[model samples]
Structure formats: structure tokens, C-alpha cells
Target: MENRDVARLLRETARLLELRGENPFRVRAYEQAAEAIEQLDEPVAERVRQGTLTEVPGIGRGLAAQIQELVERGTSEMLERLRQELPPGLPELLTLKGLGPQRVRQLWQTLGIASLDDLEDALRDGRLNQLKGFGPRLHEQLLHALSLRRRYRALRLLAQVLPEAEALRERLRQQPGVIRVELAGAVRRLMEVVDRVELVVAGSAEAVQQVLPQLRQQSGLHGGMLLEGALPDGFPVRVALTTPDAFGTVLWWHTGSEAHCRTFVRTYGAPEPCPEEATIYEQAGLPFIPAELREDRGELEAAAHHALPALIELEDLRGVLHNHSTYSDGRNSLREMAEAACNRGFRYFGTGDHSQSLTIARGLSIAEVRRQQEEIQTLNEQFAARGFRILSGTECDILPDGSLDYPDDVLASFDYVVASVHTRLNMDEKTATERILRALRNPHVTILGHPTGRLLLRREGYPLDWPRIIDACATYRVALELNANPYRLDIDWRRVRDATAAGVPIVINPDAHAIDELDHVRWGVAAARKGWLTPEACLNARDLDELLAWLHQRRQSVQP
Candidate 1:
């Protein structure tokens, strides 16, 4: 089994133990082991083979034995026993945002709410409302979570599914008689969440048919042309079979917004057999439109007038901002993260570790903040000789009343501050908007981080007057963050164009918690491109000197 698979089992075991009211230490042991395995650079299976699994930190002999069992048998007796002991769907309750093991236990024991369906039943019958701790706000939040769960149940985050999809596409390409393979649909459009992984395959019908049964949970081909199946992980996948001559037409048809395809047919007529995708656009008497902009969001009109945006690419970014380090909940230390950014050709790295209000992340206290800034100063001294610099920053919480976490003096000490809302997320639209507007008015808030706290496919962003928020950002000179964390790519791409058009610079922040996650900026860049962002409009696209000047200017503006 892969490390992630083993880690998942271990984590589920931890959660199950927590739900069962087992010893807290035992539960933490499992949780720590899972974290250790997940962060290992090498495979746990290999360590198990070497009989050195226990040598790894956090993996005791007892846990190693369980890991061995999981690796060899693809299942653990302990996990199976735990599963059998609980209601089969009890664990699924944890998938809801606010429902931790404690709350799930409360629901299960207090109201017999063991599953989403049971929770829904309780909500319908008003049993949930009668529960002691189920307040009106919690009730509304639960309803929203359930609604999001139902609406986005079929979709998967692009980052979560893209690697699997690409690997599957490559495997199909190696099949005998297959001529070519191109990914299409939402995957091609670079949508943050996708419902299906679609591909256009150039090959013989017989050759394509030969590979159908190999895939899991397949529906037989429709009209001997389209094959539908689930990837090994059960993400929905579809393949359109065509000859090399008609590859472009099939790809264009499958890689659609439905509206884009209909608009094209209405304006230019049905596409003819063309092997090149660009040729399809050329034949339509327009410039080649990028797949990311083919949402019928005026891309065709833009192309007609040669007005397509030279969308920002990943290479345009010269630094990373709003990142975490070991000073907070980040897995990597400050030096490690900064060095990793430097290795990736970034000239500057901004450490936006959690501020004091966020205890869950071990947010920095005043003393800790001073110590971290001293370390940053020391590191800057060493890095200066190497032409790299680390910026002292904080992901300062926007308090319930919309005030910044640190007082003005401490806030001014940082090179920049990413003001974000991390608590009291159930606010109504006007309240949320005003809360954010107040943060924007704070001169210390250099960038508005993840303008919405939405976790894609898991929870919807709380309601907000977005136009007002954008205008407030423009007026206050607060750059809006396109948070690069795949799950929370907030300041959603749909709103990015409006924000940028109103002269608000979009800062694509990885919100990186580890060295490896620094690459997450690519996903944010993809979403940014879809939003028509240009390098000139991207905050991190500025060079180190320009970034320093911008930060210094902001500080100056706030001065007496």
C-alpha cells in the first residue's frame, strides 16, 4: 500500500478511537504515526520490508506491527473491528466541517444521528433543534454544509484528481494501436473543481473497445464511440474515441462549457474534421482562444477584436506570499521554507504564519513574533549575500468584530499583513461584507487573504456583497488573495476579473504549509489565468525591489 493509503487508515483509526471514547493518548499516538508516515520522503512499505519502520520517529513497535499488517494485507484488523463496532456511517459524519469526533459522538448518542441521512431526518423532524448544543447558527451552518455536500458530491478538487487523470491518460496512450490522447473537459478548462475527467483518444474503435473492460465500474460505450467509467479511485471518467483526422473536432466537442459549444455551432456552424485545435478557431475567423477562457464569458468576442488577455503564467511570479512555517502550524521551518522558495527561483518568501488569536495553529505570541522577526533579520543578513530575502509577515486574524489581531505597533513591524477571517464564519451577507470592509480599511492589511473561507466541494463560501468587497479593496488599496491552497482557492476565479478590472491586484498565495506545497502556486495561477489576470495585475509577479517599494509605500500611506 502507498504511504497515503496507510496514513488514511491510521487517521481513520485515530478518529474511530476518538469516537469510541478511547484513551486520548492512544488516539494521539495513532494520529502522530499517521502524520509521520504522510511526511516521510521514502515509502513506509520499504521501511516495513527493512524491518526498520519502528526506527522512524512516532512509529512504535505496536504501530509498526499494525502498519505491517496494513501493508501486507491491505487492511488492518484494528480498523475493521472499529468499523464493525460503530454505525457504518458514523465516521462519515466527520466529513462535515464543524462536526468533529466529539460532536459526532454527541449527535450519535444524544439524537441517534449516525449518518447524513439521519442528520437530515433529525433536522426535518426538529429533533436536532431540540438538542442542547444545537443553536440556530449551528443549525444554519449544518444546513449549508449538507446542501454543499449534496450539490458537489460528484465533483473532486482539480489538484486531488489531476494526477490520477493524467496517469490514466498516459496508461491509455501506451495501449496498442492508440494513436494519441488529449485530456478534455473541465480538466482542460482548469476548473478548480471538476465533475468528470474527460479525454479524447485517437485510435481504432476495436483498439478502444479492447481496453474498456480493464477499467473499474465501466458503463459500456455509447454508440461505439464514448466510453464511461470510474478511475481506480472512483472519480468519474469519460473517453471519446475518434480517428486522428477528427481528433480536434471530438476534443473541441468534449472540452466544452456546453454554452461554448452551442455558441460556436450557432455562430460558426458544426466543426469539421480538423486535427489541430487551433485550426478549429482559425476556421471560425477568430484568433485562437485558450481553453481556460472558453467559458463563453466573452472570450469569442474578445478574440474577434484581438482583445484576449495575455493571462499570467506560473513563471511570471517572482516570490511567494502568505506562507506558513513552523512558527505556526506549517510542517517546514522558516529557513527551510525560505530556502525552498529560493531553490524554486523565488527572490523573496513571505512568512505569514498565524497570529496570536489562532491558538489552534500555535499562533505566535508577542514574544514569539519578536523572536521570529529576529530570526528573519538574521536570515536576511545571510541571504543578502546570496541575493535572497525573507519577509516578516503574519496571517493576522480578522476578529469577530472585524479588527486586526495585533495592535497597530506590532502590525506595523511586519513587512506585510494578510488580513483574513478564520472564525465566526456563519455571518450573514451584509455582516460578512462589512466585517471584511472594516479589515480592508485597516492600513496594516496589505492583502485580503482568501476573501471567502470556502472549502471547495466541502463548504460554500458565506454570503457577501462581492461588488462592495471588491470596491472596498480597490479603494483601500488592499490586494485580494487568490489563496493557492487547492481546497480554499478563494477570491474565486469568477470574481477575480471584477476585482482586477476595478484595479485591485490579485495576489496568488500558495498559503504553503510545507516546502512541497510551494508548488501549489501553479493551481492558483491557473485559476488566475481563467480570471483574465495579467502579470501587471498579479502582486507576486513584481520583482523583489518592486514588492519592497509597494510594501514600504503602503506603510508610508498609513503613517501620521
Candidate 2:
């Protein structure tokens, strides 16, 4: 097995043990072993065969034995035994935000709620609230979680499915007659979540028949189906076999949204054989639409009018913002982060560590903030001759009462601020909207971070009237952050168009906690393209001088 596969098995084992109330240290050992194995350059199986698995940190004698068994036998008796003891669906409950092992165990032991169905039934019958820790707010949050889980039950994040899909495509390409392969469906559109992966392959029926048996032997493919099937791990996949002549037409049909395809058929009749997707669009008398804009959201008409915006590209960004350092919860030191940004060709870097209210993130105290600023000043001196800039910033939390974590004077001391809501996310629409509006009204607040507070597929963002919030952002001249963390690509792309149309600047920030995460800017750029954002609409797309000027202008305009 691959190192990733072994790591997954170990992590799953750890999670199951946690749910079963196993010894804390033992469970932690498995978790750490999984992480260590994942980071190893070589396969864990090779390490096991070398009799050096125990040399790896966190892999004790007992854990090494488990790894050996899993590698040699393809299964762990201990893991299987634990699975047999627990409810089959209990592991799925852990995927829900805020429902950790402790709460899941509480529900399982007290209410016999094992599956999502059982939990839903208990919630409807009012039995969920009878437990010790189930308060009214918790109950509401659980209901919201259940609703979101149901809506996205079969969907996996785009990042989670892309690697597997690419591997499958490569496997298919190796077949005797397969000439070309292209991924389609939600994956091609780069949706935040995908339900199934689709592929269009160009080949002959005879070649396809010859390759079907070989494909079945590959991992993740279900037997008994030649043209369509699901991964044994539950990822659905559909493969469309076509001739080279019809490949483009088939790909176009599969790539466009259902609504777009229907509209195309209505307007242009059935699609004709074309050499490429652009050919089909030209035949339909429309300009070529990008895959990201294929949603039936007026792209066809916009293309006909030749008015599509030149979407923002990754290279357009000049600096990184809302980044974390060791002064807060980030893993890297301030110099490390700044140097990494410079290495990535960024002209500047902004430090946005957590403020005092978010104790969980080890938020910086007032004194800590001053110390961090001093360190940033020192780092700036080191890079001064290099023409790279570092800006002092903070991710100051927006309290429940619509106040920032830092006072106005303290906030103004920074070059910029990213005000965000880190807690009390269960507020009503009115309260949530007002809370954000108040934060935006603060002249010291430069960018609003992850405006929705939603973790993709985990928790619903707090309720808010987005139009009102967008209007307030424009009125207050507060830039909205397109937080680039894949999990929290907040200020959702759908709302980005509204913000852009209203002339509110959008800032694409990795919200990077580690240097590697600086690459998340690519995902943010993809999301920005989907939102029809252009370089002109993004604040970070400006050069170092222009960015500094804009910051100075905003600060001067808002000065007391």
C-alpha cells in the first residue's frame, strides 16, 4: 500500500479508538504515527520490511507491530475488532463540526444514536436535548449540521477527489486504444464539493471491451460494470467511451451544467461533432466560455456580447495577507514566513496573527502585540535593502456585541487589520448582519476575514443577509477577504460578484498559518475567477507602492 493509504488506516484506527474511549496516550500514539508516516519520503511498508519502522518518531514497538501487520496482511485485527464492536455508522458522526468523540460517545451510549438517521430521529422527537450538555443552542447547531450533512452527504471536497481522478485518468490512458482522456462534471467546473467524478475517453468500442477487465482489477473500481461504477471507498465514477471524431462533442455535453446544456439544445438543437469545446461554442454563435464560468448564469449571453471580464490570475497578486506567525497559532516564525513569501516572489507580506479574544488560537495580548510589532520592524530592516516589505496586521476578533477584540487606538497602530468572527457563530440573521456591519464601520478594520465563518462541509456559516452586508462593506470601504484556505474559502464566491459589482475591493488571502499554505492562493484565484473577479477588483493585485498608497489613503481618511 502507499504511504498515504497506510496513514489513512492508522488515522482511522486512532479515530475509532478515540470514539471507543480507548487510552488517551495510545490513541495519540496512533495519530502521531499516522502524521509521521504521511510525511515520510518512502513507503511505510518498505520501512517495515527494513525492520526500521520503530525508528520513526511516535511509532512505538506496539504501533510498529500494527503497521507491519497492516502492510503484510492488508488488514489489522485490532482495527477490525474495534469496528465490529462499534456501530457501523458511528465513525461518520465525527465528520460533523462540534460533534467530537466525546459528544458522539454521549449520544451513542445515552440515546442509542449511532447513524445520522438515528440522530435525526432523536432530534425530531426532542430526545437529543435531554442529555446533560445538549443546550438549546447546541440543539439548533446540531440541526443545522444535520441539514448541511444531508445536503452534501455524497459530496467530497474538490481537493480530496482530484488526485484520485487524475490517477484513474492516467490508468485509463495506458489502455491499448485510449487516445485521449479529460475529466468533466463538477470536478471540471471546480465546484467546492463534488458528488461524482466523470471522465470522457476517446477510443473504439473494441478497444474499450478489451480494456474493461483490466480496469476492474484496478483499485477503487467496482466489479460487474464495464462503462460505469463506483470506487470501493464510495466515490462514484462514470466513464464515457467515445470515438476520436465525437470526443469533443461528448466532452462539451458532459462539461456544461445541466441547465446550460438544456439551454444550448433549445437554442442550437443537438450539438454537432466538433474538434474542440471552442468549436462547439463558435458553432452556437457564442464566444468560448471558460470551464469555471460554465454554470448557466448568463455566461452564454455574456459570451455572445463579448463582455466577459478578464478574470484574476494567480500571478496578479503582489503580496500575501492575513498570514499567521509563531506570535500567534502559526507554526513558523515571523522571519520564516516573511522569507518564504519573498521566495515565492511576493513583493510584501502582511502579518495577521490572532488578537486577545481568541484564547484558543493563543491570541496575542496587548504586550505580545507590541513585541510582535517590534519583531516585524526588525524583519523589515533585514529586507529593507531587498525592497521587500512586511506590514504589521492582526486578525482581531469581532465580539458578540459588535466590538473588535482590540480597541480603536490599538487597532489603528497596525498597518492593516482583518476583523473576523471567531466565536458565537450561532447568531440569528439580524444579529449576525449587525455584528458584521458594526465591525466594518470601524475605520481601523481594513479587511473582513472569512465573512461567513463556515468550514466547508463541516458547519453552516452563521445566518446573514449577504446583500446588506455587501452594501455595508461598500459604504464603509472595507475590503472583503476571499480567505484562501480550501476549507474556509469564505466570503463565498457567489457573493463575490455582488461585492465586485458594488465596487468593494476583494482581497485574496491565504490566511496562511504555515509557509506551505502560501500556495493556497491558487485555490483562492480559482474561486475568484468563478466569482468573475478581475485584477482591478482585487486590492492585493496592486504593486507595492500602489498598495501602500491605498493603505495610507484609507488610514488618513478614517483618522480621528
Quick one: best lDDT, which candidate? 1
lDDT, candidate 2, at 425:
87
* lDDT for position 76 in model 2: 95
Candidate 1 lDDT, tens digit per residue, 1-560? 98778988999999999999999999999988987876665778999999999888988889999999999998899999999999999998899877899989999998888999999888777888767778887888788778878888788899987888788788878889899998999999999999988888898656655665544323323222777777666777788887788788888888878999889889888888888788999988888888888899988888888999999999999999999987887777899999999999999999999999898777999999999999999999989987899998999999988998999999989999999999999888989998988888898889999888998887778899988998888877789999999999998999989998899998999999888899999899989988999999999999999999987886787665
User: Which 10 residues in a row give candidate 2 its minimum summed lDDT?
Assistant: 217-226
Worst 10 residues of 1 by lDDT: 215-224
Candidate 2 to truth, TM: 0.82
Candidate 1 wrongly placed segments (more than 4 Å): 1-14, 23-80, 97-103, 106-113, 121-143, 209-224
Give TM per candidate: 0.88, 0.82
Candidate of highest TM-score:
1
Residues 288-394 of candidate 2 have per-residue lDDT tens digits of: 88888888887877887899889899999999999998788776778988999999999999999999989867799999999988988988889999889999999
RMSD of 2: 5.9
Query: Could you tally the backbone clashes for each prediction?
Result: 0, 0
